[model samples]
Target: MITDIRLRSQQLVNPAFNDPKELVAWMGALQGQEYSMAKWAVGLRLKKPDIRKVEAALEKGEILRTHVLRPTWHLVVAEDIRWMLKLSVRRVKLAYDSYWKNHGISEELHIKSLDVIVRALEGNRYLTRQEIGEELSRAGVIVGDDLVGYFLGRAEVDSIICNGVDKGNKRTYALLDERVPPMKELHKEEALAKLAIKYFRSHSPASLQDFIWWSGLSITEAKQAVGLIDAELIKERIGETDWLIHHSCARNVRAKRVIHLLPSYDEYLISYKDRSMALAPEYYRKAFNTFGIFYPVILHNGKIVGNWNKSAKQKQFGVESSFFIPGIEVDEGELDKAKERFRVFNKGGND
Candidate 1:
């Protein structure tokens, strides 16, 4: 039942937005550690999925890829990045501090490195991590490959820089102030309420614990956030658990047989802390590996029935599916249509 609601809430059943930027804004932030696959994550939720359109939005800074929500990369719209950073950066900094300390990067050195990075990108120039590291090295700061990412992530959470257009296959960073236009800022409580609403609205039937994990907030803070918007949420007792769904989210939608080829790290699976509603414990290993990798999953009527992968040979592209359950009933015609949609999304470009 929750998964059925999620199909509509996540825009997978009836995708409402044609523009990727608006869609990213609606979902709050999408996990984007896997760059190209993450674009497919966005494409999977569009009314008219287009990989090139997502790339264009990223290139134009309509949406940004940076370290936020946790210590990983997430795609957030330009309008919400400032407030979202302010809301989550403290926890993220705490998560990253150990890496800085172990690498002998002191507060003073970190500040100096950020200054060098800012100066290097001052003239509207987007520089790759290696180029930024070279700038730091030229300025007499010793920055190695292992420590470069931590330093750049530091700048990103500090609101100094964000993702720029990619150079071929390499990623670059630009000054945040330049890339994002100024917008009205929300205070701490307002931002928290806004984020909580967005999470519950798009990812409903989740628990307070789920919010705590996704927002990276302490239990006390998480409770306070839920309290702030308690009136706007619906509390339901399902089995042994108490679930929270946004009051505005559609409920009790009739279930139908549907098949979706969800990309790895898509929000539908990653946004919640407890995945039992969709991912069965028996087949967990089949969809997720020991290395913390979530593979592309096959969703059939609100449950993960199988997993899928992409393959490329010369100029041709294809998808391979593996059903975990033996002799599971799947419409070949629907599966073919799903694969064709993915192939069309990848038609003009490699990504």
Candidate 2:
């Protein structure tokens, strides 16, 4: 008796899906959560929720702690980032090396950049983007305007950036050695296998292509990894592909009416390629950024029906911002549920 793995993953983990921090913390790198306390929930494509809830989460220590993966300012859990980075550092290096080569940065210069960043940022408390750029400029090198950003990204990929202290719209980096508490080392192979298993266990019913995208691995490596775990996983044909999932997933998928107003750079959209299950291709450009980044989306019946974001006065906390209905007919159930979720997100004021 086969069943749906997506429902199973949710049940095994977030049955109610209430604690976003828990799932996000495990994945290691969710971009919007990286830089801002709260990203514009661009999932539905409209900017919603200013800055009230984000502050509240931070105050509650429920969100906005230190962590890194994907070599970016990912706002993942403090506890999970260590393991997530352990799993993804090699991939980050691959991205860094490829991007560096494309940019024509010499290996020697790369080493020098690392040295300069190490010295400049070490022991420094917090720094703004402009400050980082200035420091790089003083090191007798010109990376133009995006100098600091590119190099800092490089550092992050190299497992050097450990912390991103928020300073208004800007962020400062901390040495990985300083910010993150020590963790046991993981073998490269172990990390690869563990992450592959984790993603499958959490987000099942996915193809190899989906795994490749989520893991940031080349198609070849993705295939190899899948081969390693294929025997242990259960596969079922959905459309043209055999989606892999754990045995326990997808047991009871009774059209659970869930309206989730997720943040920008949330995992659901980015987790798979065949998103038609939740969204239509025509709305891709509409619901996502110019870069194919999915915006904050409204999910009804386990699918994206619209997009949204919020405007914050000081951009300090998350809020229960108002909603605007489109010309299309809206489901009363989904609509009310969305409003209730938004109210939960915004607690009447900032922290």
lDDT of 2: 0.58
List lDDT for all candidates, in order.
Answer: 0.88, 0.58
Candidate 1 — which pairs collide? none
Per-prediction TM-score: 0.96, 0.75
Candidate 1 global TM-score: 0.96
- Give lDDT tens digits, candidate 1, residues 72-142: 88999999999999988898898889766766678998888889999999978999999998998999998
- Considering every candidate listed, which one attains the maximal lDDT? 1
lDDT tens digits, residue span 1-351, model 2:
112345335332235333445544444345555344234331121223324544444333344443243444455555555566656667776666776676778868778877877887778455666776777779887777665666777676566764455666555666766665666766666566666776776667777877887767767767776777776688778567787875545544554445666666666666676776656777676567676655666655565667655546565434342223345455766666565555543543222
TM-score of 2: 0.75
For model 1, the stretches where C-alpha displacement exceeds 4 angstroms are 348-351
